[model samples]
Structure formats: structure tokens, C-alpha cells
Target: MSTTTSTTTRSPDAIRGRRLGVLLVLCGAIFLEGIDVAMLNVALPSVRADLGLETGVLQWVMSAYVLGYGGFMLLGGRAADLFGRRRMFVGWLTVFLVFSGLGGLATEGWQLIAARFVTGVAAAFMTPAGLSIITTGFEEGPQRDKALLVYSGTAAGGFSIGLVAGGLLASAGWRWVFFAPVGLAALILLGALALVPKEPARPGRSGQKLDLAGGLLVTSAVILLVLGVERAAHAGAAWTAATVGAGLLLLAVFAAVERRAAEPLVRLGILRSGPLVRSGGAGLLFSGGFFGFQFLVVLYLQELRGWSTLETSFAMLVIGIDAVLSPTVVPKLVARFGNGRLIFGGLLVAALAYGLFLPLGADWSYLVMLPGLILLGLAFALVYGPLTIVATEGVAESEQGLAGGLLYTGFQFGAALGLSSVTAVAAAYADPLEGYRAALLVPFAAVLAAAALSLPGLRRRAEQPDAEALPGAGAGAGTEGGTPAGAAAGLEPARG
Candidate 1:
């Protein structure tokens, strides 16, 4: 007791070095996940050509991964909670590396599809584990905020960079797209081993069996739901209806299972949180709008305008501005305006941009599209980080991985539905320009609906003290033995 000292001076260089190491490994994982998704999208056509995949089978190349990733996410997240985070992270990364290489070696369509699905499953486990580590490892004020901003910006960067990288790799050969991730995964694995700390075994998780029944029910439901939405564009109406109906039935069963489970894959009680519910809904709409708009724009540029892959990639690079703005500018805005107002405003801006694009012509220049693109990028920076904060802030450290998984599940599901629905709507019209205009309306309405949904959050925020009165609003506050003050403030409504 006599030797105890409360504080000691630490070198700035040592502190900075430690934080940088943590950020690099965490950001590297997120970046790889983002790039893998986008890279495959760009290389799909080339993959089909090389394998001589049938038109009906070609869509499965994308659909398989979506299904695997979306379906297994809950199980993955819960697994991270039960297993050590570092253990799950490194193990899953190894799985990802192996499968990505397998994908590159596949000569047949089904083999590639299988590889993609397995790789997606690996990512499902890896992503939430990485995110939870960052959320829990960094103290919950500015240090965590800065880390999150960098993490999110890196994610956006990976997607943008992948668009360019995919085009370049596909030009060499479709297989290279798959092989490239292998090399990146190996490097990331080495870095993770060197830098990511080993988490101790959780106090009570040693002997618990995974909720196998719950996992099966929920995974089946998600797989079916995604399949129905994805095929709605091309499959028969009756078939799509049957598939979606079955999915809903399974979801009901899953809900019942969760309520009764000894170790539920998801805690049903988490749904009682208003902020979590609102964030999930808004995330769904935001992701839907973003993905749908991208789908429409890619079709317009490449199919109608007859641009090469390289040209389309470059034209879309404007969205990468979110990468820079998110880390540098968004934190200041969040501190000033709070997450609710900023998310609301971002949605409205996105709505307006989509509306502005409704008047597109067959021969409209990239200059004409530039304004909407830039606005979309800015909106993403404003919205995505705040949305993440809202979703994960009040959550206990134990369940942060589950919360992250839920948010991403909504995102993947929304993206699947939005892209398919908009493509179907556009395809029904014979005139190309008419199709483009018609398609734009779907996302416009989606963004507007999301904005309307944000009203509850805004009203709740209004009832709280001004932002300046908050403990962590203007400065860093240490998280010592309890929840950060900012997190406590966010959890007030939930505790009600």
C-alpha cells in the first residue's frame, strides 16, 4: 500500500506507438473485409466468362457469399463473446486466407461459389471480433472516437480502392482478384499476431455449448430471406413469394427459440432499447439506398454509356472522399450536433441527391453526375460513423460484438434487397433513361423514410442537456472502472 502510485509520466512516443499498433491491426481487418466484398462485385463478369458459367448460375457467385455472411453473423458474434476475441480473430483470418486461395484455384463455377461462401463465413466471425476488440480495448472517450473514425475511414477506403484494384486485377485475369486477398490476408495475419493482444478467457463461458438450435433457425431464416430478395428480380413471382414466406416463418421460430434458450445466439432483451431499434432501422434504409444507387449508377455507366471497367472505377472514385472527411471532420461534427441530428441531416441530404439524379439523360456527362456523387460521399461520412456510435455506445462490453453483428446483418440484408428491387424496377421499363429515373425513386424514398424515422431520436436528444454540458462532449474523459459518461448518457433512455 505504501508503494502504490496513482500516476506516472509516460513518453508521448511510447503512447502514440501503442495506439498506432492497435489501430493498424484493427483497421487492417476491416479494410480487408470491405475490399473483398467490392473487389468480387467488379470481377463477377470476368469470373463468369472464364468459367463459362450459365446466366442463371452467374448470380450465385455473389449471392452465395451474401447468404453465408448474413446468415452466420449472429452465431459468429456470439461465438466471439464465448471464445476469446483474439482467438476468434486470428483463427478466422486463417480460414479466410485458405479459402481465398482456394477461390483463385477453382476452375469450375460451383467450386468458386463454394469458396466464396466459406470465405464469407470466415469474415462473419472475423469482423465482429475485430470491432469488439477495438471498442473494448480503447478507452471510451476521444481515444475510442479517433480509433473508430480511423477504422470507419479505412473501411470506406478499402471499398473505394478495391473498385480500382478489381479492375486492374481483372484485366490481368479474374483469378488474380481472388489471389490478391490471399497475400493481403497473410500480411494481416502476421501483423495481427504481432500486435493484437490475447484476451483472457471470459469468467463464465468455459463450459457453455453454442446455441445450436437457435443458430440453425436464424441462419436458415437469413439464408432464405436473402435468397428470396436476391432472386425476386429474376425468379418467378410465386417462387419468390414462397421463399420469403418460409423465411418469415423461420424467423418467428427463431424468435421463440431465442426467448427460451439457455445461451441464446442473440439476447431478445436487447431489442427493448429504442436507440438500438432506431439505429438498426435507419441503418437498413441507409444501406439500401446506398447500394441501390450504386447498382443503378454502375449499370448506367458501364452498360448504357459503354464505359470500360477502368473508366467506371475512376468515375466512382469521388465516393472515396468519405475516407478523408470521416476521420478528420466527422468527429468535430458529432461532438457539436450529436449523432441523432447529424444522421437525420445526412439522410435528408442523401434523399435530395437521389432526387436530383432522377432527371438523368442517356447522354448526360460525368460532370452532371458529379454533384450527386460528391453529396453522397459527404452524407456517408456524416451518417455512417454516428450510426455506428448510436448502435454500439450503450451496449455492455460483453455484447458489443453482438451489436456490431446485428448492425452489419441489417446492412447486408438491406443491400441485398435494395439492389435487387431497384434492378427489377429498372429492367421492367424498356427505355433505358426511363428505367434509370424509375430506379432512382426507390432510394430517394428510402432515404426520406429513414430521415422521418430519425425524428424519435431527435426528440429524445432534445430532452437531454445541451451537448456542451456533457462530460465527454468537448474533451476526453477517462473510463475508469465504470462506463464512460458519454455512454451512460446514451444508455439513459434504454434503462427506462
Candidate 2:
């Protein structure tokens, strides 16, 4: 009789190596996502000149992508769980590749915007699937922690690297910005095909279907919410308020629907996980504060100091140190201090970084700015990876895609809110310097609020003997047959 032991037991090194390959593939995809945005931002002037586009139409190129990405994220996450992680990831990646190439070939502004929107939708599906694969592939604890840290670091680095790359590519032609990602996406797709493992066959769910109604409500709500925020800087107050209010109403309706659905798109109980909830909140604040700060800094350097794109990129490149420290230093810190303490500490440091920069002077030398930049990088290294780990830690494997989606949705929404709020604040002031200083407060306050939000997690950690013993932690903890102990009951097979 053949035994299962021979097939199941592999050398530890082989497993480690395989997992490493998977991690690299996922990291590449995430890095591509990060870089894609930054590169496009840098190329906007060129794109406008080439297409003879108005400023309002040019802005749509970016806004279209954000709306598509944020709107469908939750649906994409659930789709991965229902369909298959590898299938969603691989399929959407192909879509991303195709659209990116189309974007490079576009002759008009509208065509480019359309291409970017579809690419963003593709990313919405692919990113969560990639994240879920890592969370489910690696066992919880040190191994998973290390993988996540490395993944997060690569993502952080991608933006910093993209700035320099965008400058170079834009010099060549704006089309190169779009063309570059096509090549990178192709490479990542090849690697994913070779490395990303297929999902194991399992028994089909009996009767549950995808919650189409719930998905539609949430997507509409999020799209409206993001659109309102994005337009806040440029649109009138009446329009923004109406859009935002409608979004809130739809969100409430979505919650009510979720409470009664037989197979809800998102299990509302997952939100009850204190760690996950806190992590998501913190992620929102962290992303908001960081992006807002970056926006102000870019304006200061480019508009105020008359710095070139390359010069600004190089100066800001110091902040990319998080990319290096995340993979190498953060794992050690997480092992010693725990994710909660580190997140708290990171927020504190981010607040300090913003505080240091609040005294911005028109004539200030780079030396004056270096401390704040360095601190910001350190804060990102500490916070970003830990937030990701905490968010996904307690979620069931089947729902990990959902968890990733929720975390990233918070991040995207926060970025939009932070940027728009700061932009509006800056525009209100007569003096440019005064406006920037006033705007700086937005991120500083946000970081402090995030620090406050993380306090409950630290308290919970202190009270629990085993950190993983928290109410929702069982799904991620050691379990028989690679499934969470209690997850089999409510799960229905996903419809293709």
C-alpha cells in the first residue's frame, strides 16, 4: 500500500528554497504595482504634451486607475478565494501585461486613461491573490514574518526606484514609462508560471454563490468615496459632499446586507478580529500620512527650491532605505519586540519625522532635511511589514485574499484622503511656505492618531500569554490538514 508520508515529507532546505522562489515572484508583482504609479506621475507632463490634453483630462489618467483599483479590490479578493489564488493571480497578471502594452501604444489621452483603468482593475485582482498565496504558503511565525517583511520592503523600494527610472525614461519618451512595466510584467509572469504552485483540489461547496449584490454595493460605495476624495482638491464643496454622502449611505446598506446574506462576500465577523481591525486602521493612517508628506516634500523641492526631477529623486532616495532595512533588519526587530510594539514605535517615529519637517525653510540646506528623511524611512521599515503581518495573521487561508484586499483598500483610500486634504489646505493659504507648513500638520496628526489606534493591540498582547491565542488567531495557528480548525463549516465552493 502506498503511504502519504513519502510525498508529504520534503527536505527542509528544499521547502525553504521553493518558498523563497514564490516570495520573489510575488515581490516582483508588488514592486511593479508600486513603480507603475510613480513612473506615470513623473511622465504626466510628457503625456500631456504628446496628446495635447488639457489639465483636467490629464488628471483623469491617474484618477481612473485609482477608482478602478479601490472600487473592485474587495470583489477581487473574494474572487481569488472562490476561484483559485494562482488562477486569479496568473490571469490578472496577463491582463495587466496586455493593458500596460496597450497604454504604451495609445495615441490619445482617453485611450491611455482607459488602458490604465483596466490595468488598475487587473491589479486589484492580482495583488490580493499574490498576497494570499504568501500568507497561505508559509506557515505562521518566524518563517512567514520574514517573507512578509521582504515582500513589503520590495514594495517600498519600488517607488523610490521608480522616481529615478521615470526621470530617465521620460527623457527618452513618456511611452517608455508604460513600455518598461510591460517587460517587467512579462518576466514576472514567466516566473509565476514556473514557481507559483497550483491550488490543491478540494471538495466543492454545496450551495453558496458569489454575493453579487453585496459586491456591487461595496464597489459602488468605494468608487464614489475615492472619486469624492480625489476631486476634493479641484471640485466644488457641494459636489464633493454629495458624492461622499452617497458613498457613506451605500456603505451602511452594504453592512446591513452583509449581516443577512447566506454567503456574504465578506464575513462581517472577520472585522471583529481586534488585531486585524487595528492593523487596517493603522495601515490607513500610515499610508495617508506618508503619502501626504511625500506630496508636500515634492512640491517644496520642485516648486519652491526649483530642483530638477533627477535631483529631487536623488534627495528623496534616502527614504528608500526602508527597502533595504525591511528585509534585513525588520525581521530581527519583529522577532524581538513583536508586531504590535513595532507598529506603535513606527508611528511615534513618523510623528517625530513630520514634526522635524514642520519647520521647513525656503533656504534650508539638504543637511537640515536629512534627519527627517532618515527617520521617515526608518518608520516605514518598522511599520509597513508588521501592519501587513498583523492584518493577515488571524484570517483563515480561504479568506486571506479578503484580508489582503481590506488592508490595501484602507491604504488606497487613506492615500486619496490624505493627498486631497493636504492639497486643499495648501491651496487655501496665500503664502506658499505658510500653506506647506499648515499642510504638514495633516500628516503629523494622522501619525499620532495611528499611534493611538495601535495601543489596544499592545494591551491585548500583554494580557495574552501566547500572542496567537487571541480569539481570531486560530485560523493562522498550527492546525491539522493545513486548514483552520473551524473553517470547514461555513465555506462553500466558489462558482467559476
Name the lDDT value of residue 417 in candidate 1. 84
Candidate 1's clash total is: 0
lDDT of 1 by residue, 353-443 (tens): 8987998888999899999999998888878878877776656666677878888888889899899889899999999779989999999
Return the top candidate by lDDT: 2
Clashing pairs in 2: 205-493
Off by over 4 Å in 1: 1-15, 460-496
Reference-based TM-score, model 2: 0.92
Give the worst 10-residue stretch by lDDT in candidate 2.
487-496
| Cα lDDT over the full model 2 | 0.86
Q: What's the C-alpha lDDT at position 426 in model 1?
A: 96
Write the residue-wise lDDT of candidate 2 on 1-496 in tens digits.
Answer: 2345653464321235556777899999999999999888777878999999999999899999998898999999999878878899999999999999999999988899999999989999999998888777776667678888888999999998998888889989999999999999999999999988777665654355789999999999999999999999999999999999999999999999999998999888777677778888999888999989999998999999999877888888899999999988898888788889999999999999999999889898999999999999999999999999988875666678898999999999999889998999999999999999999999999999999999976754443223332333443452224563222212211111
| Most accurate candidate by TM-score | 2
TM-scores of all predicted structures: 0.90, 0.92
Q: How much is 114 displaced in model 1, in angstroms?
A: 0.3
